[model samples]
Target: MNDTYKMMIVDDEFEIREGLNSFYWERFQFQVVGLAANGKQALDLMQRSDVDIVLTDIKMPIMDGIELSRAISVHYPHVKIVILSGYKEFSYARDALQAGVSEYLLKPVDLKHLGESMMKLKHLLDTERQSSQKLQSYENQLANSLPAARDHFFQSLLEDLLPEYHEAKEKMSLLEIEMNATYYCCAAVKIQWRDQPDGSLTDANKLAKATTIIERHLEASQCHSYTLKRKAGELAIFLNLNATTVSPRKSLSLLFDHIIVAIEGELGGRSIIGLGEVYQSLLSFPDSYKQARSIMERHIFRERSGLFQWDPADSLHMERKEYPYSVETKLLDAVLEGNSGNSTMYFQHFWDSCGLDSEHAELPLVLRYLTPLFTMLERRLDLHGASFETMANLHMPFTEYVEQFQTLSQLKIALDRLISDITLHIRKLNDVVQTTSHSAVQQVKKYIEEHSSEKITLNQMADLVYLNPSYFSIQFKKETGINFIDYLKYCRMEKAKELLRRIDLKVYEIGELVGYQDRKYFATTFKSYTKLTPLEYRQSFITY
Candidate 1:
């Protein structure tokens, strides 16, 4: 809050030092904080006081003004210096300037010139202070936003959205993420609380305690690791392991064993962890994450809480099957007709058609079959001008909703209740005409326009408006007369064309700026859209 600068005067003559110090320095917005008989004393004063400006003579007993200026430049660079010399030699001025003096004033110092130089230094100091404050503020904001940014980046990485390895690495560097190893693996942890009586620890408290334990153990492991708290009581950890690590699997197992014991023993909870296979490259991280998540979801069927490591030989091998679209259609038709009996029958038939048996069905595999049905039902509800939430009360994603049930019977009961609710809503809205809102479509279009230079996907847009991806695709085409993918392409190409007019940017640089990381692919797509290559288009602009 103090706008007055602190000034220190250093000289061998007691009269000169007192004479200058006695002057009304306060009128110049400065306070005479120190009067040093020599440069050495001035440097000592600087170490104790916050001296802003120093006025010193070139010749002193212990240390000269030039020596003092050099010392301040090294130790306190922010402090400004003004050299006052009786010798008007160019060499004296040159030495003072080379030592980082702000200004040099001759002896019999002119009061007006001194005042002017002091004010000028004050203005310069104010500017530097303001710049430093702004830089500090920016740094604070960056620190506050870093966690969310890191989460988003890691989410994208786990989803395999950042396909370019080099780009991903660059982002990691910018975000200050370090993974200093040649191999990586992923693990998922889920904590299930035991029944607690009144006044017991809350679930959030339990989770926090468990997270502290996990993080402490992770830090002790001395391997590069990051923990993502995906949701309540759930964590995903990515570990970077050195190639020289002796049996990474054994090391991880021991580490997680300690974590599991600490959480259960201290928090009165059970923990389940699933470890994925290690890979040599970060590009395979998504594969590892998927494997970890799949194995973790199988904990619902397990009899005990422990670490489950992915074994390539013992992994469940299920042949991939096409979605039963015909059965789903029948179920959707039954719901639309408000035929409760047929809807129930068709829902059961749909389940049967997915080739899932209650005894041997894995949770992930079961959800995979159920996801398409849920999407179909959501689309049907959207078309009928009905809110999906009103029908099913599913406030979360279908996959998460399905994970709550521990048994096949419980899951079946939940699905049946959902179907009943859907049929009931259908009967209630029998007289309502089928309609779709253009608001969600318009929002997606606006987002595409604004973020054409970023990676955009139909699923991301659909998630933005809480719609099924398939339904969103159909609605987008119905509203815009172009499919979602083509619309995205159109937006990117339009941006690319606009960037082509800028002569300063190279072709590859422009391509990267417009969300195309691969120059060849950008060129091919640009030619396909505009009937000319990017360089050719730019040359045409120059020619015109």
Candidate 2:
């Protein structure tokens, strides 16, 4: 696993070899593994030892630098050879280059140049070593490729919303398909690390070790249909929830409790899990994924490591409503000011404006509302396609505030401080933009959002924003993190959420209101947004 280089130096003069060994060892950060007085001796040592680099002087008794270089090029193609010539002869340099010498240095070489050459050789050695190690590791992993591939294939099949049973059986003969068994329930085991007493899981290696330990336990279990999948820093065990053989809840409980206790007892990191709803057939796997993601997202509320069952009853309890744009702006401004009062006022107003008391709470609503604005700012910066870091260091951290902020009163104070700081930085960036693009995007976004539900064309939008259509389209997409069409679709979809919540209208009517004339197209669009069909969404709210 260790792949740092071991270099060998050969020369007729002992002082020369010693100087190179010591100088390269200390100054250039290379290990002088071997030294020889002649090329034959050096070749002998190199053949026996795991050498990555070779340095040899020209004009030796048995083998000169050119001959040695040729031998190394032929025998150890991975080894990098450096030629040291006392005479500044073109013939010697040409022969050295022909023999595949990696570098050439004249006698009485500057220590600086020697150190630089050694550094280059060291890089080559390290790169070769890493490549060799990775190739070997890949080969070793390939030994278990059949079973790993089988597991992956099964997992894919289980995860597919529309798995063709016959095709699956043909591809995987070992599955032994039971066609009559249509009711498929899913059990998910979420493995999480316990929180540290220091309040941060900064040690990534330690967290990975904990996850590995939990995954090993599941692998040893007799759950035939179980497959482990890791995503977004969480481990998920997908199980076929068959009521006949085992109860999904009981199975989930045993795994969660066992794993949670184990993680707490062994690793010092927080752990929590939420079981998904029992869905029928492979076609409903998307539902299972949503369930898992939804559950995991709420792990912050579950207090780290805890077992949770899928209960639609908690559906109403989830979802944090979006903070209004003006309030968010004010909150961003408050954070910039480092003031608690204004931030609190904005934060409270945002939540109250959202009216989460009557609807499902969501982070997406807030993140979607805020991320776009930030992205717009980032777009406005135009730091020659510089990264977010290169752009103004203005960040509101609304998600953090929403998640960790305790009391409504405390959140308001924190919100104001957050808003103030953000607004200050935003103002500075706005000034920067005025000198450049005049924040053409700001006016463009306002127009787009205002007319998202209207039949507005790109040309019209471009003209309104006072930019060429082509350039505006490019800049708009770059600024908003989405194309104009996509942005419009997103805005309309968001508007549709409000319309859907109001039980007064039909799906088609809402579609037209959102600028979609076709009801079928609207249903598809709504599904794309909420993962629920328009009818299904309406049914979710039906009290009768």
Candidate No. with top TM-score: 1
Model 1 Cα lDDT, one tens digit per residue, 442-534:
898898888765656666887898766545655676688876766777888888888787554678867755666556557767886899999
Candidate 1 clashing pairs, residues 3+ apart or interchain: none
| lDDT of model 2, residue 14 | 85
| Candidate 2 Cα lDDT to native | 0.60
Off by over 4 Å in 1: 1-4, 195-202, 301-304, 316-544
Q: Mind giving the per-residue lDDT tens digits that candidate 2 earns over 1-544?
A: 3445678899999888887766736445557889998888988887578777788898998887788888777656667888888878788888888989899999888878887878777676667668867754654464335456655764674554233322233333222222223333344444445456785455556557766766566545533244455554455555443455556567657866787777777766566666666554444444555566577667755655777666666677433332244454455344333345665576567656766332343455545444544443333333222323443343445365456644545544554454455444444544443333437777877876676545556667767866654445545655787656667777788888766765545687677667664455577567867999988887786552
Off by over 4 Å in 2: 1-3, 130-142, 150-544
| Candidate 1 structure, TM-score to reference | 0.56
Query: What is the lDDT for 188 in model 2?
Result: 43
